[model samples]
Target: MTRPRYGDLYFGLSDSRNEANQDRDSFLQTYVDLNGSTKRVVRGDKFLVLGPKGTGKSALAWYLQFAEPEGAHLALVRDASSLPLAEVPRLQTGQEPGPERTVVAWKFILLCNYLELLMRDQGCSINRNPEVVRVARLLRDFGFMGDASGRALLKFSTTTVTIPVPKLGTIYKRESSSALNIFNLIPYLEMWVAEAESAVRHILLIDGLDSIFLNDAKYDESLSSLVQAAYTLNQKLMENRATGSVVLLLRNDIFSRIALSLPDSQKMRDDLALELDWRVLSGKAGVGAPLMRLVNTKAGRALGVDNFEVLKYFPDSIEVGSRELGVRKIPTFQYLLNMTRHTPRDMLRLFEEIRRVEASGIFEESGDRLRQEVIHEGVLQYSTKYFVGAISNEFAGYAGGPERAAAALTALKAINKQSFDGDEFRESLASVASGIEVDHRDLLRLLFYAGAIGNSIGGYREKSYMQFYHRRDESEIYLQGNFMLHNALIHAWGLRRTLGNEPESQTGAIPLIDRGAARPRRRRRKWEERKK
Candidate 1:
């Protein structure tokens, strides 16, 4: 039977990167360039991809791997906590959690080092080597490289082969020392890889970094170990010359947990890196450029769209508006366009949803009428769910429960908030959110991450404030980037009051708090004012 055409497959770019070779255009190449900043963020660097969920960090990493740019090798490691007991025995053993996790993670890297080596053209030559034999058998048995009920392992300690002297005859000896502890083996692995082929750089990427959950089960040992490994990895790279890079696709909250674990506060910053931030223009725009590059590649090639073909052509554009005002910001374009707003994820998600809806056969696949109706329904369905899901937490914080939180949403709404300020007007905050506890720097983050709210203004591009943003407007008001309940709380309270449940002292008839009650209005003066 013939294989399915590339167009016949799902648009789920995640984990389906193997299908990328078929599509060719799904590589996400548009966002490779840096913005005005001079930071070196190209693939294969010890960079951190830090942002709230769904910012497309994982997608970009996959794109880079597909591109195979110079010095670009990626590992994509899952955090050790996610490793099954079958994968790593150390997690099951009762011992000092920190040191054990660190050891296991290094061994994890060691496995990646082996895989990268084995996959390379030079590595396949040493296939007959004993070390390669041992390791391969282990991986196969562990199910990492084999089928279900893993019962195999490989025996490749370390091997490098090339057409040059000292390589074709001698293998790059694999050491058994855990670099997370010794901190010297990482350099050795680098040197070994270079020996195999000096021109090749393997990039080690660890996505799903947050999957490594820690608890009293081992007294957080697994996490401590991962953190230690990361620290050592960072130090080694900082001090030595770079042959490749290690990247982690991690959640901000995970990093926050890591920050609290570090013995030295400065080490956290030195070792911990972020790709997305809730801060200035430096945060989302910085990462958005590269991510959009990935989506453009995938959408154009997979869906046959023409606007953003190459990974690089997908230029970032954001929506900016005056909340209390409107402007005729017109531009000349020869082509008729249906203007809409999107972030990198929105572009990909839109494509994915479109593909799914069309293929689901919910409507008769008869003509343009069905397709148009589906598109309209799709947009509304996506928007309503996205808005409610995004603001649900903030709404809950304001209303003090999940029930009222559901009402904060509007059908197919767009981002329209005017500003974000971390300080100043914090006083106006209701006690609704006062009942909850959340991480710092995430007040605005809850809304931003859910892809519900955005900067009403600014960045590489702007969109509705209710829509997620790749950038922020500069002229908006300020609100804390903290875990804030949205302003809809007042309305919720009013509704509850009208239903006869609100406290009489706090309803519209009386102020919730009245300062200087001692001061009284004269009865005659009040009566005359009322009559007038």
Candidate 2:
């Protein structure tokens, strides 16, 4: 009898953003409703969606953007980091200071932008609405849509403008109108909106915020302004019970850094924040149900099978027992999760690699289960290789650029030691080949956040779990003197895994590490430098 062959299993497995842009039908099929997030957002109950990188925040945003409900209109703000905050007139009363003014400015900006988008879509005119006409005229004059004057407007400490509306008998005192405060005209705008079609709900989606404020003060301030804008807009809607919502999709890292400084940040978190955490509360668990549900959703839809039975398509296990060359017995899904950073992207990434290896014919096909070599070497190397490359690219915009982070990852890979003591780890990093002087502590913190290394604190079991960071007040690394490379990456990094605290002698082949020095810088250069 002929041996049964493994069929192609990988079907459009990837991060949701890619799926959202490339494959709409498959993206929708694989999308799972995470705890009624779609419902809450559509109902206009929540406006702030927060999560760490790769926690499906963008996916949710894109889902809502395409899945507009019956009575709601969605307007997507593709890039919030580049929002024209300077174009909005700030409130300058003694009680409302700079920050308060900024909040009001953001509210004004959202309202006008939404109105403009709505009008453009419906092919209607704001000519009948005096307040909108005034706001639109000012926004256009200031170059709200990429005007040089817009940059000038951002630098203005105060603005003064005079508007004459004979129909409404509204005239600003020339002396008192030194600043164009939009809040002063709010009553008129509200009146206009209340009288207009009140049934059609308007939803604004603000996305593409990741990697925006890495280490730049200008970008940071811009993000803060966007957050403020969302908050102010929400408050305005709630006050009038308006049929509009402004949703801000942000990374947890970015939000955490800015939330403490903003006055109403707590109110937003308590009332409107939706954290897209995929990990379970228990530390020992390999994977959470939410992450698995996402995987199953995609796999089932792709393979034309039931989502609950996704495990049937995968190998039963990667290893059977503690013995060397253990027969493949551990389920492949759990094994993959154990090596992951507990993210859907990582999970899908590993599966994509598996499919690639299977297609490459690197190892002989043996039924449907992956061979030990294929599972350990091919899949692990692929995942870790891409993950390390991504980190290098992520840190490429900072002071030292990609080399700063790549040097750390390379040092770890070259050391080729799976688990090490605090002193040993510190010594290894210090003795790395690269001459660049990354702070030893900063190197560890970087690795911890990147999910390259995990800590051991007596009871916790995940080799890559960095509980120390979570426990710290500032999310800094608190090394417990012992750490282990993630089991999945250990093989790719040419490091040995341990059995009962003893190093296994049969470590897989080591792969070459990219030192990151020769890589070209891709971040935007300064103006003078760009001129050259």
Report lDDT per candidate. Answer: 0.37, 0.57
lDDT of 1 by residue, 1-532 (tens): 3323222433454333444555545444333322411123343333566654545555556666666543334333343333442233233222343465444434444444445444554534334455444544544544444223212212111111111112221233443322112123234334433333333455556565433322233434444455555556545544555445455565554555555565753555454454453222212233333444544454444454544432121122212223544322211100001111223444354445444565677865524222444543444444444423434543332323353333223211111222334432232222233344433234344344333333332111231112232222211222333221222221222211121222222222222111001112233236547778
How well does candidate 2 match the true structure in TM-score terms?
Answer: 0.75
The candidate scoring highest on lDDT is: 2
Per-residue lDDT of model 2, residues 415-446, tens digit only:
67776666665677767744877666766766
Query: Worst ten-residue run, lDDT, model 1?
Result: 331-340
Regions of model 2 farther than 4 Å from truth: 1-15, 69-71, 83-98, 120-134, 145-198, 213-225, 281-288, 303-308, 320-331, 360-374, 393-397, 421-430, 433-437, 460-476, 498-532
